[model samples]
Target: MASIGYFLSCEQFGPKELIDQAKRAEAAGFEKLWISDHFHPWNDEQGQSPFVWGVIGALSEATSLPVTTAVTCPTFRIHPAITAQAAATAACQLDGRFVLGVGSGEALNEHVLADPWPSVGVRLEMLEEAIDVIRLLHRGEEVSHHGTYYEVQDARIYTLPAEPVPIYVSGFGPQATRLAGRIGDGYVTTIPDADLIGVFKESGGADKPVQAGTKVCWDRDAERALDIAHRTWGNQGLPGQLAQTLPRPRDFMDAQALVPRESTARAVACGDDVDAQVAQVRAYLDAGVDEVYVSQMGDDVEGFFAAWDEDVLPALR
Candidate 1:
């Protein structure tokens, strides 16, 4: 069966808001859950960036829906060695209901650690090594390693899930996609593009889950909603290589300021109409994703889900 999920941006709302939203999402019939892990909000104006690992703990107790990070970088800020410990503990806390979604990482945040950002190929190498380290630790083995990018001395996880923790790899291009196929238990992505799936399969992945997510805003006034989205988060729509390596969230604003509002709006759907929202989600399903997650972009919760319940969910069903 094709499953539907809800994604929450960890940095966008506070703990109370997260708990409330998790309850509301479960009530709305979302079967899966994806939460973002970020140390910083794109801009300080976007508000609270809570400790996501802590939020995941509360979420595990709050909802029956399974939780996974959309994608967490186990490179900088936190090493894979510690990530193994955290994920292992989280899995136990969730009672075997957690997936460890990891990736090569972005320079915008990781570079803040005073480490020089390497080239894409180097990042991929680090990611591959990180995966090896994380899995070994998850297997409850005493891991000691001295690799090109990481060096960990004899470590073993005291708390691990009864079952193995599945690792999901996020990829955007062919190289990363191929790496995901070669090593990941599953694939994680935002774009609903099947070419990515094929890349994974050819590289070695088969029959594993592929999850995708998109954004929508539920508002009574469509124009006003679009304006708010474009102002605060429009920078996300920027294209090409240099955009992903930004040093700060404000860099997004400055670069996105060069692009037109319509371009960003193309990625974010806002409506007072439910049919329109359903169609946006359908595009993801058509792209051959096994699961889809919808993030209602703004803070207007009551208004968004009411439309989803009345209109979108039925059409999808």
Candidate 2:
């Protein structure tokens, strides 16, 4: 059976709240955890963006469930070598139960240092080079790389898990999906497109794990749940490329205004309907996703967990 995990939204909750959610997820019988790695929330209304690495440290002590960064950008903001070190440390802390999920990244977080945001092609090229550098350093031998996009000189990770960390590459389109298949240890994406999963497998990702995530709003009041989903995560309804191209939360907020309430209604499963929640997750599983991580968008986390424990998880399993 495919695994069902909880997604801890760093973009929506602070560090302490995330750790608490981790523990709650484990207690509620969620098999694993996926956490967002973001420098900023998509918008101020979503409200929080804690540094992911520090929160991962606390999660290591708080929950035994495996953890994966839904995706991290090693191409910009932070060098691949530094990312390798951080991933290694996290793997050790989790006792080899961690996966480093990487992506080409968005301008939202990458633009913070005032660096130019390259085009999609250039970003993917840089991401490929970054992964190469990270893998070399993870070998525990001094690596001096002078690639077109990055230069790592005599860098070696001193602390590492018994095994090298598994790197899962995130891809949303055909080009990036093929690249993920060619180089990634596994694949990560949010959409449940069976065609893309086929593309990944044919491009050499066969036998590797494929992970995806989605969000839901679980509340007793169905209408109120939809309202919260629209307000807090309406960014999900933004059209193509806007999410990757927009550089600031305000820009996203501005674009978010165009997202109709109906779009969010179609995108997210809301309310206390057990059948609705089960079917939403089953959509990903039917699309060949090996693991599906679900995030609750409402504030009533305890209610969400109780519903999952009593009705949703049992039905899915």
Best by lDDT: 2
Worst 10 residues of 1 by lDDT: 39-48
lDDT (CA) for every model shown?
0.82, 0.94
Q: Which stretches of candidate 2 lie above 4 Å from their native place?
A: none
Weakest ten-residue segment in model 2 by summed lDDT: 149-158
Task: List TM-score per model, in order.
Answer: 0.96, 0.99
Q: Model 1's lDDT to the true fold?
A: 0.82
Error of 1 at 217 (Å): 0.9
Looking at model 1, the pairs that clash are: none
Q: Report per-prediction Cα RMSD to one decimal.
A: 1.3, 0.6
In model 1, which regions exceed 4 Å deviation? none
The residue-by-residue lDDT of candidate 1 on 9-103, one tens digit each, is 77578887887888888887778888887777665556667887888889888888888888889988899999999898889988888999988
Residue-pair clashes, model 2: 0
> How much lDDT does candidate 2 score?
0.94
Q: Per-residue lDDT for 271 in model 2?
A: 97
